[model samples]
Target: MPRLSLIASCLLGLLLAAAPASAREVSVPPWGSGESRGEDLSIWLVTFSPGDDVPSWWGHGSLVVEDRRLQQSRLYNYGMFSFSDAMLARFAMGRLEFWVGHSSVGSTFRFYREEDRDVRIQELNLTPEQRVTVAKRLADNVLPENREYLYHHYNDNCVTRLRDMIDVATGGQLREFDRAPGRMTLREHTRRYTAVNAPMSVLLDFMMNDEIDHPITKWEEAFLPDELESQVAALQVKGADGQLQSLAAKSWNFYESPTRKRPPAEPPPWGPWIFALGLALGGAAVGLAAWERQRGSRVARMLLGLENAVLGLVLGLPGTALFIMWWVTDHTVTYRNENLFLANPLTLLALPFGVALMWGSQKARARLFKVWVALVGLGVLGIVLKLLPPFDQDNWRLIALILPVSVGMAGAFGLDRVLARLRGGDRASTGRSAAATSLKAP
Candidate 1:
């Protein structure tokens, strides 16, 4: 997937900054309210549901500190970033910087409400000291020098940052969740959320490597906002009287958007469907090749060339990107992708052969046939690797999509005849030339 263009980023920045003047004040709730137990302070977890945009597809969360005495609420958001060229360049280089910034609760809620995202709030049941600590930490986090931090999608994102702070405030009680197994892998979680956009889901799955496929702990799963909310709601904390109570003093759906629905619990079942689509395309290519071979018609040959070109571009472009992601960039999740075998870069290199085949070049036919065979072989190799203990990438969907197409195209172009002729050496070359001449005869 391409990075957000500068224009889109700027527009998003503007939208984020366009809050009403009354809601624009940066309010930090007063932590010291004269009460020895800090009775006037309250902390809440605010979670916003996923939105239509790519960036908002994973959802977001913020820490809200409220001062009951002053009736003021401040939201500490860790998802802020600039849209300047320098920041975008760094983002493209996989070194994005995000910072914590304070905004009025009114402004934050207004923006998300306008976007039609669901909002949930949970009042944290923290002791007075814990509440004071969390409030002060959030205040310190928004400071100019302290706010900026390196962002890691799975480990140190906005949600995870809030999760860590909560865990610390609870005296590491959240660490108890490390023993529980996660429902799915990071890749699956990502697919589940992004499944609302089918193409984007597949593209992201293709780009990510096996690093995200391992089973994680529930603690790790808290990287997502909803997951964290669920885990936090289940937590039990000891009260002043030594009785265990729910960590969430109160929980409620603050705003449930009628237009936007929550993402599905599981990722879409797209593998089999994509495989079937590939088979259909491959069959069509074979039929076209057969028609061209039988009639030697100009139209059939043109269609054959066009099919090859289209397939080449579709496979080659992403394959080239995968190559760059593995060796040229710092996107760790995209490194060592298994899809590279299915979408071979050699297909791009064989563009001239595709064009030549359009003009009835025998040499191009031979070369293109060889390239297709190599691609098919690589696809098979990927499957074979799956049988080994070391290769555990879940890329069957891609294999299913690319393998049959390679096989069909190779068969369509007469791979057997090409190989037989090549084995026959000098005699076969002369025979091919005579055959070409004879076919051209009126």
Candidate 2:
């Protein structure tokens, strides 16, 4: 999930900029600008639970630094970005830019609380020298000249920023965390959160390629806010007594929202399965019409031809988009997709011939018969390829949904053409036999 706070903060930034210059500058003390210094500063890791919005589905993370003497708290957020028309275009193309921002902790906490999102905080155990060093690093990072960073969704984000900064403060001891056994792939982790957002889950599954299916290290999974929080809470570091100590000295939930009603029934494999069934039924009807050659069979054939052409055109879109992302766009995860063979855009180019067949062109139907046979072959090949190495894509759901439809549609058209041709030959032979008998009798 990208930063949900980014959109809100960007709008707020624009509104504040229109005010007077003195007022435009947020009253929050600039990072490290307070009169008080030394160990009076304490470091905290703040986490906000997942929200209803798409961007907030995975939650958020922020680092808070409090000055005891000044009685003020500041939040260092790595989730801010400048939103604009140009930025939207770049964002769509996967070239993202984000900035570290400084803001008052009171306002930040209030915002999440009002949104009814659960919030938690972990008081980090850091030496006085370590605290000052981390604070200074954050201060420099939030400076106008040093803030902007190229954001990668899974590798570099708000949560990762906090994790990295803490590791720095801990003298790399954070990296010594024991790997959690039986780690999951990035896709699995994402699916766990987005299961309720069925549509988004399907779209993400389609757009992202096999790159996400590879198992991620526990450290890599810490990019997610909740994962980072849990990992930080469990982290152990060297203590002054020569024993391991928990990195978090204390932890507590800052806010808890009212319970939410359970969501409606989810449409998981159901949606894809229904789509396959519909296609299969339609193909079956076409096969029956071709075999019977009834008075209305021509119309039925035309309609089936037209429908498949349209369906083919539509199905090709995701594959085409993936192709662009892999070859043309900068989206790293979409590169090297194995789903291309199963959802080839080349099928869409057959639309012109499908239209011709719909208009009752015998020549077009003859050519399309061959195409349908090829489709059956391709479907079978796709199934066989799944059993091979390097093609080991975990796309069983997609394969289940699409392969049967392909085979059904192809068999319907191919077998119909063959049966019709055989019947025509039989009728011609019978007519010739009847004419020869009549001539001989005369």
Candidate 3:
């Protein structure tokens, strides 16, 4: 599971690079900055929930917005945020001020400021028509097409929302496959946070000046008195039923500076860290529950579960290590490298060895179990250490590692627990093994 997740993470980076794309930058001053103080101020926010028309093939994003005013852009899948970068040159040769925040699927969250600017925002008089237009355009015009700018997404959230436009334009004929109308099948993703434009960069951005049920005073802190006095504020869009749309973008007072600090969410340093570790605990809890069902072998099942988990951790490490090495890089369009590694020979052989160590009778090779456990610990350590610089940067790009690490860690642990309980030693009979994982053709 973890190996497959690594491949998926690496491949997602590839797909973001290889997809078909377009670019459109809206000219707006940074949220609080106005005319003289700021010229390139812009804010682009997009949300892609499950029910929207985005194609599953495109792997839709959610809650993503890029604002040059705030100098921040965070992409999302479903409602959770994923990190993404915008080329500064992509925006008419102006300097960028940015920030990022996102949580992983299953309640994990990460977000923070990358660079804090002393810049202040000004309030421009926007006509009611202009305000409606901006809101509707956000709902309609921006954040649709998604990805494929050849390098990074310049408001891909809005481009992705364009999927809705295409669907409406074609009367649902363009992308019938993903049009399930009302299914809660949204899958959130986690990815990178980038700054500056490389090669395929483009311009136009968004800035945020939020005012929830927040203190009017804190707003004064992040903005100049003149700017705050000008009166630009966030809008609240609620459906008739008051339910938030999957594709809705809202500017809320999530946090403010000085008086109310925004705490950071950091990366886990070791293997089986955080999420997977939680999963292991979850599996252990389940094993504890099943303890009563097993004949005298319950103790053996617990031990085997430990062994299977260790071996799975070891077997999946190489692919995972390889994945962590390049998970957030913009080097591939097809991400086929990690995908291919999952099916490698060594991984295949190791799966059964792991299973045997877990399910083999009480007399199973304790030596093999100990050896595999040591190897896995080393493999995890080596990868975590190698992951130092970029992988562990303050950037949310590290979130990509969570899926693989957690899944692989959990799958191995869970399967081992089950195999121990069942004494399901016959890998051939079950006809399942690590060799079964691999890349898929598009």
Candidate 4:
């Protein structure tokens, strides 16, 4: 809550001034008219319910409007602070009053209250000309979109009523003053929208003198950009001579949404689906072994184990790869490869399959298992390295192969031991048989 002490009011007059241009009177909105012209408030509150009867709740908080005089020097400053202040009042009322630069970094159209920053106010009582000089000094640092808003119109205070002054005048056209936001309409916007208030330096000397606006704090959810944003999907960008370029795009919001998590569905239907698939695969393996035996193959046992390894690979490997591909590439979606969409859980399965194949194989199946296991292992390792804290959304692709490479080495070593033991045993058995035959013949 922002306390409006007498000291705050006294600080207001001294806060800003401009070379006196003809002073113009400010108007009151229809919703702002109260029982008395003087509510004993320095600022008045105006409420604009949503025009479309959208069931938005706006009356719960206090709204205030202040009379700020603008001059040539303070002309731009008015656009900055007055609008910014008005927006703060709107948010305090606990509703969407007006939008500044609807969630952009360093957006110009904004609203803010002095109390939010713990900034103290002083009464300067400067001549009109001096005010203009100070106001100009502040404009140099004003950015178009900023994720900073303090005590918006809905905070049980007087911030909401006055936030959309210029916006209301332009028939709810915020883009005129807030060019920083890419584009928007009232009906289509959501909570992800953000706005920034004019920097304090624009209104006060100390703001610029002390560099108070640098490294600002207090970013509200309304202003922060989500992992995925509408601007990329909706906005149209114009090139130098006003030709429409390709539609603006941003990465999709693919991170697990905090708002939509749910527990696994009851009875876990996958329980049955999994069993059926295993049975089918088992039947296929039996048929394969039977055919190989009819062909007089000596690799029957090895082939059966190979079948298990292959089934395990099918049970889980593709999901790991698909998810890694998506994450590494900034959540860009693509078609599934081989009915497999790689995901984290699938990676775990890939590992087990690799281990199973390593221990169960008889011959050629072992070699194939080693190759597949190595690739999957390396892929998993790559995903891990990419996910390390230092590598964020920007650099994930760079380390995507760490798992594939690492697994390749493991598979190689395992294959070597299997080959050495199998060959050595075969040779020993042959020697024993030949020696026994010679002794018996003699």
- For candidate 2, the TM-score is 0.80
TM-score of each: 0.85, 0.80, 0.28, 0.24
Residue 362, model 4: lDDT of 46
Candidate 4 Cα errors over 4 Å, as ranges: 1-345, 350-402, 409-442
What clash pairs does model 1 have? none
Candidate 1: which stretches are off by over 4 Å? 1-29, 32-37, 84-88, 350-363, 415-442
lDDT of 1 by residue, 1-442 (tens): 2433332242232112111222233534465333323577899998998877667777888889888877776888888876567765565456778778788787778888888888899999998888888888887788778988887788888888889999898888887755599999998888888787776666667767898999999989998889999988998977777888898999988789987878789988988898998898788777887676557678887777878888887677667766765786676877888888887578775566778878877788778788888888888888888888768987777778788888888787773365455657968788999999999999
Q: How accurate is candidate 3 locally (lDDT)?
A: 0.30
lDDT of 4 at 186: 16
The TM-score of candidate 4 is 0.24
Per-residue lDDT of candidate 4, residues 210-309 (tens digit)? 1111222121111211201122223343433556442222222112223322211121222344334434553544454454445635464445445544
Cα-based lDDT for every prediction: 0.76, 0.67, 0.30, 0.28
Model 2, residue 391: distance off in Å is 2.6
CA RMSD for every model? 5.7, 6.3, 21.2, 22.6
Misplaced by over 4 Å in model 2 are 1-38, 83-85, 178-182, 260-310, 350-383, 386-388
Ranking by TM-score: 1, 2, 3, 4
Could you tell which candidate, 1 or 4, scores higher by lDDT?
Answer: 1
Worst 10 residues of 1 by lDDT: 13-22
Question: Who is ahead in lDDT, 1 or 2?
Answer: 1
Model 2 CA lDDT for position 31: 37
Worst 10 residues of 3 by lDDT: 200-209
Sum up the clashes in candidate 2: 0
User: Any idea what lDDT model 4 has?
Assistant: 0.28
Query: Tens digits of per-residue lDDT for model 3 on 304-400?
Result: 4564445345435534434443344432221323222221223334455545645654333443333334444543453465455432222122223
